[model samples]
Target: MKSLPPLGDDAVVRLSRQGGVAAIHTLTRPREIAFAQCNIDQRTRICSVLEGCLAIEDPASGRGDQRFYEIEVCYRIGEQDDRMVMKVPEDRAPGELVHLWDKGEVL
Candidate 1:
C-alpha cells in the first residue's frame, strides 16, 4: 500500500467546496449548468469526504451527448499511502471484487 496522509478538515472542506468544482470543469469543459452535491461525510470530524454528481458531455463511444457522473474526494491525515478508489459493478457478486492495482505496481 502507499502512504495515505489524512488532511485537516479545513483543507479538505475548502477543496471540496471550491477546488473540486473548478477541477471538474477544467477536466470536462462541461456546458454551464448547476452542479449538485450528492453526499457529504464529516462524521469522523477529522476530514471531509464529498461525493458530487454533474452532467457532462459523454465521451464514451456510441453514447449520448450528456450523462451524469459522480466524483468522490477523500483526504486522510497520516503518513501512509493506502488510498484507493474502487468501482463496484452492480451486476457482480460481492465477493467478486478485485483490486485493479496494488501500491508500487506498474500502471
Candidate 2:
C-alpha cells in the first residue's frame, strides 16, 4: 500500500456536516484530501480524528493533554464494507483519542 504524504504544519483540517453525515477533509498547498466520512452515529471517532490533526498542526491551540502523531489513514477497498480507519496504536493513544482497533469502523 502506498503511504500518504505527511501533513505539514500549514495543513488545514475542516469538518462539515450534512444531515446525519459528517465529512472531514485536509487541505494542503497542493491538494485537498478527504480524510474521513461518517454517519452521526460515529461522530465521536470522526471528531477525535479531526481534533488530532488540528492539534498536530498547532499544538498550542489544542488541549494540553492531547498528543498528536502521524497516523496511517486506511480504507477497506473492494470489500463489502467501506470505511476510513485511522491507525493509532493503543499504547500511543491518549485518554481522549480513539485507539486503532477500538471501534473497527471509522466511517
Candidate 3:
C-alpha cells in the first residue's frame, strides 16, 4: 500500500500529471482533510472539507515523468467531485508524513 504523509489542513498538494476521473480505488481520506470535526464518508469517493479551499493541481507541469497524479484536495462544505481529470506529482512522496498539521492549528 503506497501512502504519502498526511497533509495539513491548509497545506496545498500539487500533482505531477493529469489524472483519470475514473476515481481511484480509494479516494482521499476525509480524516486527512479536516482537523477534528465533520469528516466525509470514506466510501463516498468525494472530497470533503472542514476549512480552507480545495484544488487539484499538476505538480509535474515543469517536472518529469508526467504520469503520476495526486488528489490535491483543499476544503469545502458541499458535495463536489473533480469531473475534470485530476493531476498528481511524480517525485517520490514523503515518508510517514501523515498528520501534517497539528489539528486546529492553521497550517
Candidate 4:
C-alpha cells in the first residue's frame, strides 16, 4: 500500500488523466476507476470510464447534506452484469441510481 495525497476528487481525476488507475478500499467497500482516454464534464460531474460513463451529483434537494450523492450509470459495458452495478452500498442510495440500457440489457 502507498500513501495518497488528500486532493479528493480532483486528485482522482488528475491521476486518471495521467494514465494511472486508482483502487480505493474503505471499511465499507472497494472501488476502482480507470479514466484513460475518456471524456469528463466537470460541471455535470460525469466521467467516462472503462466502457461507460458515470454521473455523480449532489442533489439540490439535499442541500446541507454532505453525505448525499446521486450516481447514475448511463450505460452498460460489454456484457457487464447487473449484479456488479447493484453492489453499491444501500446507504449510498443505490435505488436512486438510474441505469440506462445498453445492447438490450439494463445497466
Candidate 5:
C-alpha cells in the first residue's frame, strides 16, 4: 500500500481521482461527489470524485446535540470504490431522501 496524499474536497460538489486506496475526507460543507479508486499496478490509494457539493451549515449526519437527521448509507464495492451507493431512507424531514437522490448517489 503506497502512502497517498491527503485528498480534499474543493468548492465543487465532486471529488474524483484514480485509485482504490482508503482515505478520509472532511465533509465540512455540502457537495456532490463520486468516490472511486483505480490501481495502476498492485498499489492502491484512496480515490474520490468531488463535484456538485453543497456544504450545509447543518450536519446531515448525526453529529450535533440536536439530531436533525440520521441516515444509514451502504456502498457497493466496484473497481475503485463501490459500484452503487445505497442507504436506508429516514423520514426525519421533508425532501430528505429526495435531496440525496438529487445527487448521483442514491439512498
Candidate 6:
C-alpha cells in the first residue's frame, strides 16, 4: 500500500454537524471530494495516519471559525486492478494515483 502525495496545503476534511456529513475542500476548490457517510471514521483514521503529509488543523487549537469538528487533508495510494473502484469527479481526477477510499475491501 503505497501512499500518495497530500491533496494540498489548503485541503480540508470537514466533519459536518448534520448527519456527520464529511467532505474534502481546498482553498481554490470547495467540496472537491465527498465520502460515504459510513466511512467517516475510516476517513478520519486515514487522515490521522497521514498527518505528516497533510495540512491538518484542529478546531480545538483555536483555528478558524468553521463549525466543522476538525480539518484535515486526504491522501491516496496506487491503484490495483483487483480492487473495486470508486467514482471520482471528472474535475478532481486522481490521475496516476488512486484515493484510499477508491479501493473497496479485497474480499
Q: Per-prediction TM-score, please?
A: 0.22, 0.25, 0.24, 0.19, 0.20, 0.20
Compared with the true structure, what per-residue lDDT tens digits does model 2 show for residues 1-107? 32233332222223211111222222111212333343444555544554564433332322333323333333434433233323232334444333332323454
> Model 3: how far is 58 from its true place, Å?
4.3
**Candidate 2: clashing pairs of residues:** none
TM-score, candidate 4, is 0.19
Q: Between candidates 1 and 5, which one is better according to TM-score?
A: 1
Choose 1 or 4, whichever is better by lDDT: 4
- Residue pairs with colliding backbones in model 4 are none
- In the range 1-107, model 4's lDDT, one tens digit per residue, is 12112222222221110011332323213222323323344212323221222232222423332233223222333543221121122234333122211111123
Please write out the lDDT profile of model 1 over residues 3-102, one tens digit for every residue. 2244343222211111222345544322211112212232232121221111121224122322222222344536432333222221221211111111
In model 6, the runs with Cα more than 4 Å from the true position are 1-33, 36-38, 55-107
What do the candidate models score in CA lDDT, each in turn?
Answer: 0.24, 0.34, 0.31, 0.25, 0.27, 0.31
Instruction: Give the winner by TM-score: 2 or 6.
Output: 2
Please report the candidate that would top lDDT against the real structure: 2
Ten contiguous residues with the weakest lDDT in model 1: 96-105
Candidate 6 whole-model C-alpha lDDT, 0 to 1? 0.31
Error of 1 at 46 (Å): 14
Residue 61's C-alpha lDDT in candidate 1?
A: 17
Error of 5 at 26 (Å): 31
Rate residue 8 of model 1 by lDDT.
Answer: 43
Instruction: Estimate, for each residue in 8-54, the C-alpha lDDT of model 3 and write its tens digit.
Output: 33333322223344434343322233323423342121233211112
